[model samples]
Target: MDALSLLANPTLRDIGAGAILVLVVLMIITGRLIPKATHDREMKTAITRGDEWKQTAEETVKVNAEVLSQNSQLIKANEVVEAFLRSAGPSPADTSPVGGP
Candidate 1:
């Protein structure tokens, strides 16, 4: 009986219109907030990626510096070995081609 009364009354129509208006207002509010939320998320992601790239660049520079230091030490050792060879005479097995007939 209550359902039939609601269906037969103008009050029920007013209540339905008010409910629709509330839903429309809520939809508009959510529509405005969604883009702001998406922008915030994208900015956070960009910052994280930038930080990761910076760390990787720093690590690459450190590794290259270590490799350069090692290479300098190796070059010094090679020069010392070459100097010792120059101070010592050639072995008997090392014949000079310049003296060949």
Candidate 2:
């Protein structure tokens, strides 16, 4: 019964309203304290998977940076070698990969 009925018939509905009120108050209090998404098993799993993806993305960026740096160094070294070769003109014994006269 509602609070008004329970109040009018205190002998019959003595603890009914009080019990419902306590339950509602408890729910309100706990809802504020508890995290909604973490309570869900699927949501917790999704959060963990999101963290894994973030870590993977960070690792990918780090590896890509290292590869880019190595490529830059290789390009610089190749330029230096080509400049030396052009200055030296064709060598009789030069069997380099670039192949020259």
Candidate 3:
């Protein structure tokens, strides 16, 4: 008999049809629904990990920016000192005769 006819007759003689229906339901739950739930859980965990990495990257960028600013200031200060020394020329103490001493 067809499935519609089997549902119409709910007697002991139709036990086989009922058992088949129960097995199909169990298979659908195990093969499709359970795996989907597990996949969704894994995706959530991965997204959380990605967010943490993004935060760390942002902090690293801020630190790098501060270091770059400090380096630029040091370079400017070094340039100023070099320019001053070039303009000052040699001191009088260094004017002694080279061959005598």
TM-scores, all models, native as reference: 0.56, 0.51, 0.52
Q: Write the per-residue lDDT of candidate 2 for residues 1-93, one digit (tens) a residue.
A: 798876788576666778877878898788744556556876789899999999999999999999999999999999999999988886777
lDDT of each: 0.86, 0.83, 0.86
Candidate 2 similarity to native, TM-score: 0.51
Better of 1 and 2 by lDDT: 1
**Candidate order by TM-score, highest to lowest?**
1, 3, 2
Best by TM-score: 1
TM-score of 3: 0.52
For model 1 the TM-score comes to: 0.56
Off by over 4 Å in 1: 1-34, 91-101
Off by more than 4 A, model 3: 1-34, 89-101
Once fitted onto the true fold, the runs of candidate 2 whose alpha carbons sit more than 4 angstroms away are 1-39, 91-101
- Model 1 worst lDDT window (10 residues): 92-101
